[model samples]
Target: MLTSFYKMHGLGNDFVILDERMGALPLTPDRIAALAHRRRGIGCDQLVTLHAPTVQGADVLVRFFNPDGSEAGACGNASRCVADLVWRCSGNATPVLQTRAGVLPTSRTPDGLITVDMGAPRTHWQDVPLAMAMDTLHLPLPGDPAAASMGNPHATFFVSDFGMVAQGHALEHDPIFPERANIGFARMDGPHHMRLKVHERGAGMTEACGSGACAAVVNAVRRGLAARTCAVELDGGTLRIVWSEQTDHVLMTGSATTAFEGTVDLAAYPS
Candidate 1:
């Protein structure tokens, strides 16, 4: 069997979008890892699949499998790419996206950017699902960490500096998080902007991470460090996240580009 997919990028975080409807293609951990291999595979931070909706209200379901075959509940930049795929497939200008988090409304903005309603921030101790309960805002990580959740669990920490902690022996094999989270070290340059360097679990260091940016903004706003609406500058580019005034919905606006489209051998990831 052959699996047809579209290679797309939201900023520099790229993905391989598999349209299973193109055929019956199943994925496994080994296959996912191989597909994400920079040299031997399609090379992406994550792989997305468009599947039939599991819920009644959703127009389509968006699912993302990280390079390590772990599922992520929310990914802002990927959401934009998924929206464009759904909109193009359905020929609808406005598409309703549903994920484990909840309903996400998406559309193209005036500036030709994809905008996603990322829903509310989940910052409670239990919601973040830390090993034990603590004041998530002031929780002591083995390092400077802001334990929070955009959808799936994430722990964002601001390092005293980026050089000392650029993903070497400092983070890997650590026991702070049971499922080991995607680590982002940030430096706040101003009240409204910050720069991020990441050591994503499974996907090591990458150019950008949409969900990581969302988590960073949510945590910053909760701590009163940054405004509700601010820009997160990642290694790849910048993302705009707004913890909305009236709805508390985190709206992420960014660009999505189609890299190329082709078919991959399903023999690689057979069910």
Candidate 2:
């Protein structure tokens, strides 16, 4: 059957969204991987699915999947895009999204930006779920990266240069990180600004990573390298991240753009 899909992007971290709110589709890991293939399928950093909310107070249940077909706990950029879609469809200015990580609350900024309250960063070693307990502030790894979970495991390496990014893949699979992790190479530009590049676990390097940026800022703040409110510049664009002292929630603000829309035959892809 022909299924409708929306192509959306947030700071160049793009996704192919399949809306299954009306009904669930037959989707498997293999099918998801096939659709996410850049060369032979609709290209996207990740594939997202929108389902009817199963919990109270949530506008929708959103799921993120990588090109390699693995499910992710959270996706910051994709959340903004999904919030916009729900707000448009339901006329709810503030849309709540439920994911594996937790429920996320979203609102629109005065200047047309989407702001998602991504809850809080988990700094506990058990939360990051390392193979063994250790100090999350400084991992027992090269460059002394800090670890945090923004609904997913993340390790931020504060570097003066990005040359260390070449080791992202290696560190992502390091023994310490049991489930693997998103590796971020961050260069502090100022007290309130920094530049970042992320090697997402399943997706590899993307133009931008919403959760990765949040984790980076949270870790930076813990290290006193950046202010609570920081601006993260990625290869695709920039994002405003604020780690609220009062709420302990990380608010991520950025633009969500619709690239195009199309229909695809799910049956044609591998199951």
Candidate 3:
């Protein structure tokens, strides 16, 4: 059977989105990895799927899979892409998405930017789910990185230079992370501006990472290095991240675009 899919991106972090709301589509880890292979299949940083909402108040259920076929608890960039698709199909500017992390509400600004309410950051050692108990504010590691969870584990290392992309691979699999982590290296351009590069847990280095951007800002704020609201510049584009003090939620605003749409026969891929 052929499955229709949308090719979309948010600041160069691309995805293959399959809407499974109307019908069922078989998706196994091997097939997902096969479909995400750049040389052999439809290339994407992640694969996303939209399904009928299973949670109260959620407009749709969104799932994110890394290129390696690992399921992600949340993906900020893909959430915006999914929100845009949901809006275009339902005419609802604001849509609620349910994921493994929880329910997330999204909105479109008058200027056409998509904003996702990414909920609060989790800073506790157990919450970030570190292997052992330690102060999340100052992890006992080289460069003294900080850790936080935006539904997924993340470790942010602040530096004077933004050339730490090479360190992401080793840091992402550090023994302390247990489940591994998205590694973010941030250089502060100003009190409210930052330059970031992230190595995703399963997808390796990407041009952009929304949740990584959010984690960068939150870590900066926790370290008193930046203001609550910050602008994060990634390789592909920029994202505005605001950690609301009152609501304790992180609001991420960025662009979501459609590259194209097509169909694929899942049976042809590896099972």
Query: Which regions of candidate 1 deviate over 4 angstroms?
Result: 167-173, 269-271
Q: What local distance difference test score does each model get?
A: 0.78, 0.94, 0.94
Tens digits of per-residue lDDT, candidate 1, 102-206, equal 878898888888888888888887776676778887667556678777776667776657874565335533665565676777777766897877666677787
Model 2 residue runs over 4 Å out of place are: none
RMSD of each: 2.0, 0.8, 0.8
All candidates: TM-score: 0.92, 0.99, 0.98
Residue range with the least summed lDDT across 10 consecutive positions in model 3: 160-169
> Who is ahead in TM-score, 1 or 2?
2
TM-score, candidate 2, is 0.99
Q: After superposition, how far is residue 209 of candidate 3 from its true place, in Å?
A: 0.7
Which scores higher on TM-score, 1 or 3?
Answer: 3
Q: Is candidate 1 or candidate 3 better by lDDT?
A: 3
What digit string (tens of lDDT, one per residue) describes model 3 on residues 237-264? 9999999999999999999999999999
